[model samples]
Each structure stands twice: as C-alpha cells, then as structure tokens.
Target: MIIIIAGIGRIGYTLAKSLCDKGHDIVLIDSDKEICNKVSAEIDALIIHGDCTKTKTLEEAGIEDADIYIAVTGKEEVNLMSSLLAKSYGVDKTIARISEIEYKDVFERLGVDVVVSPELIAANYIEKLIDRPGILDLTIIGRGEAEILEFIIPEKSKVAYKKIKDLGRPQDYLIIAIYEGSELKIPSGDIELKPGDRVLVLVKKDAVDIIRKMFLE
Candidate 1:
C-alpha cells in the first residue's frame, strides 16, 4: 500500500515508522523543514517539506498513486482540506484527524473516509481502562459503531476451554485471533480457547459489556 501521511508530528512520525516497518510504502508531508529533515533521517519514508493542503505538494508526494492519504496535522483545517484535496486527486481513502469534537459530522459529510479526534479517543481509552481492567487495548473503528478489543482470557471465563463452534454461532461478536504464548493463531471452529491466552474480539459497541462480563467476570 502506498500511504501518504500529512504532518510529521508525533502521530504522523509514529504512523510512518510503523507502516514502513510493516513493509508498506510511506510518504510523509509536513510544512516544517527541520522536522522533516529530522524525521527523514529517523524513518524509512519519503518526506516532502510543504503544505499538505496544496495541490503542488500533493503532486510532489505522488498523490495520484496513493492508496491512502492521512491528514493528522495539529491544525484541523489543514487536515480537513488536505483530505478533501487528496480525495480530489484520486486517493483511494482519506483519513483526517480533528481535535474539535463537533466537526466530526461535517468532516465526514465533506467525504473524509475516517475522522479521528485524538482527545476523544484518548478519553475513551482511559475510560475503558478504568471501567474494564481486563481490556488491554481498545480500538474504535467503523465510525464508532464497533470496537476491536484485546484482552487475556481469564481462567474462569465462560468461553475458556470451549471450542469456538460451541461458543455459539450467529453471535453478536467475533473472536478473530488468539495469542498463545508467542504464537498468534486465527480463531476457528475446533480451536479451543485456553485460559491466559490473549484474545482479540471484534464486537459492536452495544455488545461490549456482554462480552466483557463473559470473559472478564
């Protein structure tokens, strides 16, 4: 995947490095030349020093062939405009980061594929951590309609030691993956979930409490 990340701040830099480590082609754009220079030396990605909202910079960053364009600048206006511009340039997907809680709807209405608010996400994450100690990680996706939760299967979990098939089909949630020690395995009908195994579950927001109780309580 060819990904263009606008902004070289903490989030953009981290995203670029992680994506590059995953063997994806990443291009970074930023208005700060010094940050770009510093980031260029640290991350294995193409760095363009320019405004992401500008077509000239987008062209320089090869927006025409970009599979994904992510605008995560500190400025919400820049992020929104850059994403809109990327969409116009034929990028397959556009993700914009906004700090304002109220502009999510407007940004989506303007055609951004994903609108992320760092503050909102952080608050949710912290809330989950306090409310659900069993959860190790929580990623809200599908526009907040669903979440992917990572947790360890407790010894007393109702679903532990049971084959996935026996856990009941046509369920409200899906156990996608299990990590046993150092090995990662995809969930299947006959695979029995063992206690202490790390599990990744994809479930709707409404089903979170139900699954948490079954596994954590």
Candidate 2:
C-alpha cells in the first residue's frame, strides 16, 4: 500500500519507518527542509519539503494515488485541513491524530475515516494494564464485538502443559499464535501450552472475563 503521511515529526517519522520496514510505499511531507533532507537520506521514502495543507504540496506527495492518507501534525488545523483535502481527492482512507478528544466525533462525521487521540489511547492502555495484571496486551477488535489478547503463561498455572484442544471454552476463543523463545508458531489442536510461552488469542468480547479467570487469575 502507498501511504502519504503529513508532518515528519516524531510520530510521523516513527510511523513512516515502521511502514517502510514492512515494505509499504511511503511518501512523507513536512515544512522543514533539513528534516526532510535528513530523513530522505536515512529512510526509504519519498520526502516532500512543503506545507501539506497546500494543494500543490499534497499533489507533489502523490495524494491522488495514496492508498492511505495520514495527517498527524502537532497543529490540529493543519492535520484537519490536509485530511479533508486528501479525502476530497478520493484517497481510500484518511486518518488524523487529534489532541482534543471533543473533535473526534465531529471529524468522523465530516468524512475522516479515523480520528485518533494519542493521549486517550495511552491512558486507556495504562488503565487496562492496571486492571488486568496478567494480560500482556489487549486490542478491542470488531468495534467491541471481539478482542485480541496476549498473555504469557506462568509456571504451575492450570493451563500449563495442556493441549490446545483442552482449554476452557474453546468454542468461545481461538488460539491464533504462540510465541516461544523468539519463535512464533501457529496454534493447532496438538500444540501444548508451556510455562513462559506468550500466547495470542482472539475471543468474543463477552468471553474475556471467562478467559481471564481461567488463565490470568
């Protein structure tokens, strides 16, 4: 996928690097010439040194063919306007990072596909960690209908040394993958749970409590 990212600050630069590492085509825009020149040489991406809110600048960054348009400048106005222009040009998806939580609903209503509040997301992650001490990670998927969770099996746990097919409420959850000592393995009925194995599972939203009690508690 070709992704056009406006603003090459910390967030934008990090995102570009990750996507570029994944073999996605990336185009980056920013007003700082030195930063653009530096990143252009270091990262495998097309860098445009211009204001993204301008039509000429966005066109230079190949907005017309961008599969994903992301606006994440520190300033909200620039991010909003650039995303709007990208959407008008029929970009397949548009994402904007907003500092203000109040504008999230309004931005989505105006045709922005996604509005992200970094602060809120971070806070929620911290709260989840505090509430669920054993859950390594949690991602709410399908808009709350399902979830993807990561957990590391503890020694002497009830599920340890058990086969995948013997887990509690297997009908309500799917063991997708397992991470064991730097290796990732696809789960199957014959796979046995072991201590310190990091497991990734997808489950129905309502099954989270049950699974937590079975493995985490």
TM-score of each candidate structure, all chains considered together: 0.74, 0.84
For candidate 2, list the clashing residue pairs, or say none: none
> Where does candidate 1 stray beyond 4 Å?
133-207, 214-217
Q: How close is candidate 2 to the true structure, as a TM-score?
A: 0.84
Residue-wise lDDT of candidate 1 within 1-217, one digit each (tens)?
9999998888998889999999999999999999989988999899999989889999999999999999999999999999999999888899999998899999999999999888888987899878877899988886778899998988988888898888853367898899999999988889998999999999888888888888776
Q: Count clashing pairs, candidate 1.
A: 0
